[model samples]
Target: MDYSLLSQAPLFKGLTADNIVTILSTVPHRVKKFQSGSMISQSGEPVNSLIVVISGVVKGEMVDYTGRVIKIEDIPAPGALAAAFMFGDRNRFPVNVIAVSDGELLLIEKPDFLKLLMRNDIILVNFMDMISNRSQFLSEKIKFLNFKTIKGKLAHYILQKAGKDKLSLKLDKTQNDLADFFGVARPSVARALREMEEEGYIEAKGKYIKLIDKKGLADLTIE
Candidate 1:
């Protein structure tokens, strides 16, 4: 087996494949495979193990009161799922993690993971740092959720990414995926783009977005 998969997980970072093999010989872990569209982990489920993806992509999502499925984020292989949830008082996952494609996951029990951390000061410190970073990321996600309009969200996102000046759209998301990300309907996103163009706020051709009026976009973000 290519124990190198261990290197991909944040918890097992810096450990060589041989070292990972040695560690795994004593640690309790099991690998599970998921088909595309399968729910890897459910929201409100009793959290126990730390899930590390060895291959493929998974999306963390949740439904709001209005039955809108908001995608929290996407996790590609070699990423740990919900690493921040392992220690907190309310440790349950806030979102459902569903596989976007065929994937393999390594499940390590909390106690076993904790045991590994106990013997390694580096691992413990790295774990804490990971959680701290996750907290900051969640805070940003909350801020993103606060945008009142699709245009406001799009303006905020474009400005935040490529800056508040003239630039091409630097999006890593498809139109449908971007719509899901904004927690809005696809037509709404399309309408917002059309409205922006008609209002002379932006000049967009395909994926390219030239900020015609940066100040106007900024004002819309706040309004």
Candidate 2:
């Protein structure tokens, strides 16, 4: 196993490679390999272990009643899988995790994870920080979901990225990424951007955007 990769994981952020090896020497854990497109975990399944991606990309997705698949987020190497759900009474995966590429995972069973956490203060602090950050992310996601149109979602996203003073900024995510995040088709996002530019609401040249009508964008965000 690559102790360096394990040390880079968010759960072990502050620990060194030597530290990880020393610690894991006392903990029972295993490294598992997965193929691309394989299911890592399904929604509603118990999160009985602390699983961290060691070497690949994975995506979290959900299928609604209409059978439309919505991508939640992508987790690459060193990212923990369902870290927040591990200890809760209703500990279950909120979305199905599917491997985007062949990868390796480090699995530490729940009880063993608890033991590991208890043995290291840095690891415990990292775990708590991860959970708190995830809560804020989910809150923002819910707010975006409340938007009724793709244009509205795009407007809100721009406003949030630009902040209170900035009027020009570059989009951090690509059109395809934005589509997955908005739970809409990629062309829908591209069309919305084109329409917004055509309507004089913004000036877009590739990823760079200059807000032309800030108030108009804000109005779109209003319920």
Candidate 3:
């Protein structure tokens, strides 16, 4: 186990070396590796344990009644708590957590985990902060989905991912994945991307998208 990486996790931030060693001694440690597109947790499944990502990315997505997929959030970094449903009253997961790349994870059973949290105030605060951040992110995503046009939603998404006015992104996702992320049909996303390309707002290659006119895309997000 990489204790250094574990120490860097927000949940363990500010923890002394001795404290981390103590926590590790108390908890049983195991590492599980997963491949891309593998489901870490499925919707409606029992939340028996808490999963911490040791490496790679994971995405939370949900499919609606009409079979339309909506991307809830993307976990781009490590130390992401993938099965947070266990923290609430409902034991079943609400969304599917899928691995976006080949990665490793650590799992701790819910019962023993709660015991650890009960004895540690720092761990409890860290867990609460993680949940609160996720809630805020979901709220923002809901607002993005309410946009009247596919173009508007896509524009908002691109700008949000870019994190800056001028940026480049390796869009490894297929058109279908983009459709799922934007909560629109495949054809709708394709058309919107084409329009953006034509308008010089973006440039798309096989698996790369370059932001050419970020201001134009950002403008679409404004009322």
TM-score of each: 0.70, 0.82, 0.58
> What lDDT does the true structure give each of the candidates?
0.83, 0.92, 0.79
Model 3 lDDT per residue over 29-94, tens place:
667998999998888888787777877888889999999998877775456655457767787878
Candidate 3: lDDT of 191?
88
Which pairs in model 2 have colliding backbones?
A: none
Candidate 2 similarity to native, TM-score: 0.82
What are the clash counts of all predictions, listed in order? 0, 0, 0
Residue range 1-223, candidate 2, lDDT tens digits? 7778778788888889998888888999999999999999999999999999999899999999999998878999989999989977879998999999999998999999998888889998999999989888778888888999999999999999999999999999999989877878999999999999999999999999999999999998874
**In candidate 3, how many Å is residue 15 off?**
1.7
Clashing pairs in 1: none
**True-vs-predicted CA distance for residue 198, candidate 3, Å:** 24
lDDT of 3 at 173: 63
